[model samples]
Target chain A: MSSQAFTGGHKASHQELPPEFQDQEESIKITGFWMFIVTDVLIFASLFATYAVFVNRIASGPTPAQVFQLNTALIETLILLTSSFTIGIAIWAMRQNRQRMVTWWLVLTVLLGMAFVSIELTEFAGDVAAGWGWHTSAFLSAFFLLVAAHGTHVTMGIIWAVALLFQLRRRGLTTVTRRKLYTFSLYWHFLDIMWVFIFTVVYLGGRLI
Target chain B: MHGGDEQHETAIEPGFDFISPRFEEPKFPMHQVWGYAASLVLTFAALWMTVNRIMSPSVLLGVVLAMAVGQAALQLGVFMHVRESRGPAWHLVPLGLAFAIGIGLVGMSAWIMLFKSGVS
Candidate 1:
């Protein structure tokens, strides 16, 4: 992969690509990327199922109906949903190979992500202030686990996006960088999907119960 | 012709190699009009329902979650090119998800048994 070779400037057709990359580079990358996504899907699936099984296992703690604030939860939900939209724009920019555009869109995505997390943390603090600790009961425990896990994923996504931003600057949109971004986009969207479960099981279900 | 003895061996080399260095579909296609319109309708409906108190609080929450999942899927399929990956690497995504679930379930069950067995 020299830039010249990649751009088809010099190498002859019979140059025989490097042995390791002669026949499986794209296949390998594709496989690796899909494997990563499948594993992640399984992880989120388990969380959803677990939350379902233990949703009512209050074990002498505040129930979801008692602890959840639907109004504020709605706001948090909107923030995250909007952020996902921004990230979609970022991916579109990447596809167009608009370097500056991608960079700016990612920056916007990172900012929105930070805002979502900050709002969530504030909400958590408010819950604590009202004396609803994670250990207060089984319901709260599950609540903390489900929502916090999703939060952690969002945080990781923000960090990943930022790192990729730097990589974009240093490496530009090379094939390697493009693949990396494609993977990260998958990851970011997956995080959004996981939050859907959180909103349903923890927030809405909690209130209904 | 550089190696004149290679004429017979040309059959050994496949034209379309499995490890093809080139990739054709570099970008995922976007249906901006449809995606935007659908998203707007969904969001507006969800918002109006929430504001007007049509759905119960819990139901509202569920609807919101569903909306998010829908939007995320749209982005992944349309913008991320996950489904377009040449190999089965998408399988790893699900596998990772399964392991994460296993750990969460086992850990939570253990905690419940340890602390709340008699109570609940």
Candidate 2:
């Protein structure tokens, strides 16, 4: 597979690179995205620390055992885990140059993400309606902030994937499009990993403790 | 056709072939399949542990934390292709630094908050 075959370029070496790493510029961009993920990891870590500190401070508010629903958390976990799997398959399809398959998998991923967000929002609404708002306690505040930040990221991911779908329809599987999709998959997977911790430390731990 | 084949053969310089192995694409999505299966198993295991009340709180936390770390590693290695950089992989240094800082931030915060001056 040479760049000449795909793009009719004179230089053959360009085609040798993968679609995501098609050149020095794209390669650097991928590395930079990795760094961005690292920063995001630290941000989540700080939030997790804050949550740990205030986890016991109920201040006459609802405890985690009272507010958290295992069934809802489990459903959200399954949806997100499925989305992560679909996004992986989407990237795999991208590497195989199957544009339609990639697009559909990404579409599935976005739908699953939307489901997760909807469920999360509903849970929050229930909490607030029950008068367990963030202002009620430090524990609730930290919990809301951590979970909402993740929800915000997933919302952004859905928007990004939809935009990429349009790009894929217009441009096909060019180097630029491929790199963007690849980075998007990385971001999605990172969020899934964060969710793993959130479920374990927040929901399950809260119930157990 | 023979001449074109010869040209194609010669176009790939000697040293370039050393890196050509990676260019060979796989026919199946085996890695993704395995990653998905492993992640599902880990998720269910943690859920079952918590749901069944199979262990004490401290033990359950340790087991769940280990599973969380394992799931993250699976995503990074199999799904994210964390090592599939195009160059010398300078990106890893910053990633390592970030993890260090993250652990320090979490641990130090807990220590600072948990340990306070005593006033009897």
Among all windows of 10 consecutive residues in model 2 chain A, the one with the lowest summed lDDT is A2-11
> Residue A23 in candidate 1 has what lDDT?
28
* Candidate 2 clashing pairs, residues 3+ apart or interchain: A2-A15, A3-A15
Number of the predicted model whose lDDT against the real structure is largest: 2
lDDT (10s digit) by residue, model 2, range A22-109: 5657767898899899999999999999998898889999889999998899999999989999999898777778889999999999
DockQ of 2: 0.35
The lDDT, on a scale of 0 to 1, for candidate 2 is 0.83
Give model 1's DockQ, 2 decimals: 0.20
After superposing candidate 1 on the true structure, give the runs of residues whose Cα lies further than 4 Å from its correct spot. Answer: A1-27, B1-33, B43-73, B87-120
lDDT of candidate 1 over A98-130, digit per residue (tens):
779878877887888898899899989988998
Candidate 2: list runs displaced more than 4 Å: A2-15, B1-25, B116-120
